[model samples]
Target: MIDVIGPWNRMHHQDTLEAMFRLRHQVFVEEMGWDLPLARNGRETDQFDTARTIYLVYRDEDGAVAGSMRLIPSVLPHVLGDVFPELCSGPVPRGPAIFESSRSCISRKARRKDPNGMIWGALTCGMIEYAMLRELDFITAVMDRRMVDMARVADWHLNPLGPERRIAGGGVVAVTMPIDTHALDTVRLQRGVPDPVLSLRFAGARAA
Candidate 1:
């Protein structure tokens, strides 16, 4: 299940958050070789993991962190605005209706079993659904070429903020993806999920 999170419930999921950090450490640092700060305790986190960050954590029946992603309000300091401003043609898009998404990851263990890319679809669809539910207009990010292509083929109303440029490992570009009912419908059709990817009926309680 994909669990939506906000400042209100962040402290209640310390254990899940820690597990997610560990999974991120394994995927981004150890496997992908990203030069991010490695916590002494082996969790991978940055200054961006703040109370304001909204998260969607995909966990299985046994409570394992299969995949996760986070959203930072554009009004706040975020990677696209502070670190990769050069990637875009002008000032990054910032407003109450737009948010910057980052730190998306899926555990290697989960990937090994998900050959159909269902997990990926679920995460992306859930993110879009969650954003629209919050009345957000769009979600922008600096994504690599492969991710850009995925968004393109997935039929997202993606608008490139700038041309793709050579980066450390490959090409990357800034993009703004719309979050609306039409986009959500297309994603559902593409993924063939009749119901919302998440059981988004939050009751102000811990996800079961």
Candidate 2:
């Protein structure tokens, strides 16, 4: 069984950051051959990493980073609005409750029978718990095509932006998932969120 937990910005987070970089390089750069030439620092990062964000990392029993992702508030640096401005035609949503999910890649070395892998589930659950604790208004994810169906399967509130499509990693479509007031009312209906304790971090008024 994998142990799921949060990494504070202090010790655990530092290690997690390194692990995330390595995983991204391994998957996005070496194995997948998407990043072209490797980076001088051996990382696959963008402006989103430095934004107002919280990272959730999954590690093995040996404490090695297994998979990871990040959460960014829409008010700040979201991939679609802040970074990938070409995709949005109008004003980006800034609901005081919106967070954009980014950098959600797992370790390529880790094998999985599923499409997105187990880390995605743990990260989503952890983000929900964290959102409740922080009183966040909403959570969002920029959905590349490959994971759009996964979002639907997971019962997340997702939709495409229409017209413009960005495909990466072998023709995956792009979309988004927004967890606003409507989503708050039905988070439990989402798959793999049975244990309410997993949502303790993002609970309270924010969850309502």
TM-score for each model: 0.91, 0.71
lDDT of 2 by residue, 1-208 (tens): 2222333323435655666787887777777777544353778776666624566666655778777677776777667676555454555566766677776766655556335344556666666666656666556555566566656665664666544464563433334555443443344445343444242333232333
Q: Tens-digit lDDT track for model 1 on 168-192?
A: 7689899998887777777777766
Local distance difference test values of all predictions, in order: 0.81, 0.57
lDDT for model 1 comes to: 0.81
Candidate 2 clash figure, as a count: 16
Per-residue error for 24 in candidate 2, Å, reads 1.7
In angstroms, how far off is 56's CA in candidate 2? 0.5
Taking every candidate in turn, the Cα RMSD to the unseen true structure, in Å, is 3.0, 4.8
User: What's the residue-level lDDT of 45 in candidate 1?
Assistant: 86
